[model samples]
Target: MISYIESFKKVSESRLNDHLIFWAKTERKGKSKTEIKEQGLNIYNVSDVESLIDTALERGELLVLDITEADRTFSLSDDGKLSLAIFLTDNFCDAYKAYSIEVDAFTEETKQLPLSKMTIMKYFYRGHSINMLKENLALANSSNTISIAYHHHLISNFYGITSLEKDACTFHFAPRLYVPPEWIGRKVTIEIEGLDEPVKLVVTSPYPNKRYYVAGVKLGRLNTANGFYPVIKPRDSFPAHKELLLRWKLDDEIRIDHHLKLNFKFTNSQGRFFSSEQQLLPDVAGMKKFTLTTTIDHSTLSERNARVIVHDIFNHYEIHEDATLVNFPMELHHSVKATSYFSKWYKSWTAEKELI
Candidate 1:
């Protein structure tokens, strides 16, 4: 049996969910249905981008697949939902094929697992070979190559406004919008409650990739006393200066590329500042599971204080903070590799379903 459910079906077929295969966005949206009764899937091959995909998710996104050129450009369009295929193979289509015995064996082990609703859906996306799909996603991670193409989502609401105690104050506005590149360098005025004079802050940074702004600066003054973002006061005690690991399941859209500039920050228990902003680049983008990063690895942290409040900083406004996950870097992907294949029975396949 090729699938986990198929093996399970020998004992009981009724327990499995109907394997609904969607090849194109149209089919997923209910505009099309399969007319031909075939056991195989209806998937769009990597070379064929038939649908009008408006939304931009770049894994070397393409109107057509080109194996020769490694270069790509960023553009914005006002189109509807984008439906396109990302190449699982970096250079060769043959690379995505089952090349070794280890992958095949992994597929067998997976099929033997307990049958469940979640597990069944995973097995279906592995195409003919489950192991191949696993390797497909691991392609970029294993190579130590940076994700040259990606983007963050439209960030809405998650932001922090901090008063840097008379020295400087910070505010994040347009909390939900992707600030266009043109807006940077434009000047804006922010009204501070305590200060009689409105703080004149320039849009020094425009971070649209993460939806919210990644960083910002208050022009007037620097606070010598202290600077702090929101902190997650520990419920239990914290260990001494043991380095903490942090990971972010970043919006898959945030592409870490040569052109992309990024920064991250967090504070130690002592209220001392630390940054590993540069260390996160292509590395974060290439992470298999969660993006692996280290916090202030110092001995000064105490029971009530240690590493906390991690952020994926595009700027101050784009700060998304979370507690450190010690076991950082989850194994890439367990399943769900959407591969397109050109079936020999295309004539009959087209007759059965609408493909537009």
Candidate 2:
């Protein structure tokens, strides 16, 4: 029951959707699976829920987690009551566990109502019981701390583009790719519409511990103009609109680190404009969810397409002399969207099969 679905099953059994476990409530009797699942809610563990709340606080994001106690109050030990009161008083200042209890008990009450009129409650021990409850609840509600359900399918997509200078631009790749150790010294080429030739670059692992890769052309090597290089410069004509900002919602299981920088390159396409790099800042690398960021001038452009080269950024002094293309920050890929798509497709296909 430590796993997410198993825990939910333990909590809600076959009668409820996974997300309902979060609300500490359940659908009334006779609600079908279709009716319940359509609510499209997310299930979060106490840690993730707490980390998310902290991240939201850091970004000053507006999140409303409404926990309304029942009309009737239940008895607790004097110490337990005081601890719970103190936790509730400070606006749940990192009290995701308390909220978890509230929801879990509420859901239990719904199921038990048929059997008895008694109110159900979670028992917290006396004294430091609040801390113990938090620890035990976190353990009881644990899920894979870093496992993404559909990571291999790459549901995250190319979300946006940003311009760092006349010659350099950054591509926002989703759900950072795991760079292989073998790819550290590999060479790759990127082709752009306006460029006379493909941009040649090498990949290097700057942070080996993090397993992050960077691919970029070293400007120092450009001193001797070899015929093989593309002319990296601004286009002759600039579009009226030069800026863009794009955002997307992150899936529940996707976590990212905040220190990421957008992998950037130099190009001269008239359609492209100068943009700023939006770092997907998750607290611990691949441990916390991050907000996607992109910026352009006030004007926006249509989605541009390019062949993803070793799709993955760096500074001049910071760039490894042997590195080819610069490595950049990454977003969670299209796994969520792809998962949703396949689920719907599979359900429809199954229905057709049943009819046949």
Candidate 3:
């Protein structure tokens, strides 16, 4: 019994190694053997390999095995090998199940509980892990219905897309198409809607029809003259209102009849803002100065707002107005400068600052 058990363990380990090698071969097609080695799971040793087989059999976890007396080989029964495969598969399935449960629990918890962004991130991470486990398990069980289900589940959960297509045998994320890299021997995916909740697609073969690369480039950036600007001040100050100018520029493509508006609030030192938060001020509003000129048409652009804010130092409070809208004929380069007018009453009231 001891020898049988030992032999079974050895066989189980060998079988696992074989399966792992097969998996590695299919997974690392374009990758080098050295790269696989760097992934922390390369080849197995003779003795340790046997130990895995033994352990599985001892635990009655070996599902399938084959034993043939004619060949004078004492191997595991087919059931034993299958049992082991199922056992390994269970780890991933179990993780996915747990993830689903956690998601349900999170929904329930959040219904009555106030959760922070970090808490939501944790839930997302758990879902991501579940997706990864499902992906790996699908790779291990390729060509099997179980693998297909796993792939489908992962695609639906992470990428918000699912595939039941006839052409593709395997399930895939619909939003993303897998493309083979030109220079590198690995597969790359082009994301359509930026990286947020991006679609993930796997490329199994190197075919011209299976790959695509993104072309054309357009760039834009936001700029301001001074990072700090007072939106409100005392009534006695030099200027009764502050001016804030914003500019925009476009490259490559020309935009027609572009309308621009910014949403912003005046935050105090403690990050608090009062009601009536938005208003259209003259300096940034109106349709007169929003148009783009031909000189800075394609490569550069600029826009300016006059007296955008009023500072009431006597009241010790600032009134935040609505973002002004700028309508232009074409898109161009742009910049902004904000000036503040302070009142004497506002300055005197805030001068004697006291901690609350």
By TM-score, the best candidate is 1
What are the TM-scores, per candidate, against the unseen true structure? Answer: 0.23, 0.20, 0.18
Cα lDDT of candidate 1 equals 0.25
lDDT of 3 at 193: 27
Please report the candidate that would top lDDT against the real structure: 3
Candidate 3: stretches off by over 4 Å: 1-15, 21-43, 63-65, 69-98, 102-356
lDDT of 2 by residue, 1-356 (tens): 11232211122222222343455234334555566547422333444444433443354432222223421111123343334344333433344456446545643453311101111122321223544544543443232111122211211211122323444322322212232344334332222223333344433333334333333333332211111112223433322221211111122222222222232332212213122222211111222122221211111101111112111221101111111122222221111222233354446656875799
Residue 108, candidate 3: how far off, in angstroms? Answer: 14
- When superposed on Cα atoms, how far off is each prediction in RMSD? 22.1, 22.4, 27.9
| Residue 158 CA displacement from its true place in model 1, Å | 28
Candidate 1 segments whose C-alpha is farther than 4 A from its true place: 1-25, 28-123, 128-131, 147-211, 216-322, 329-356
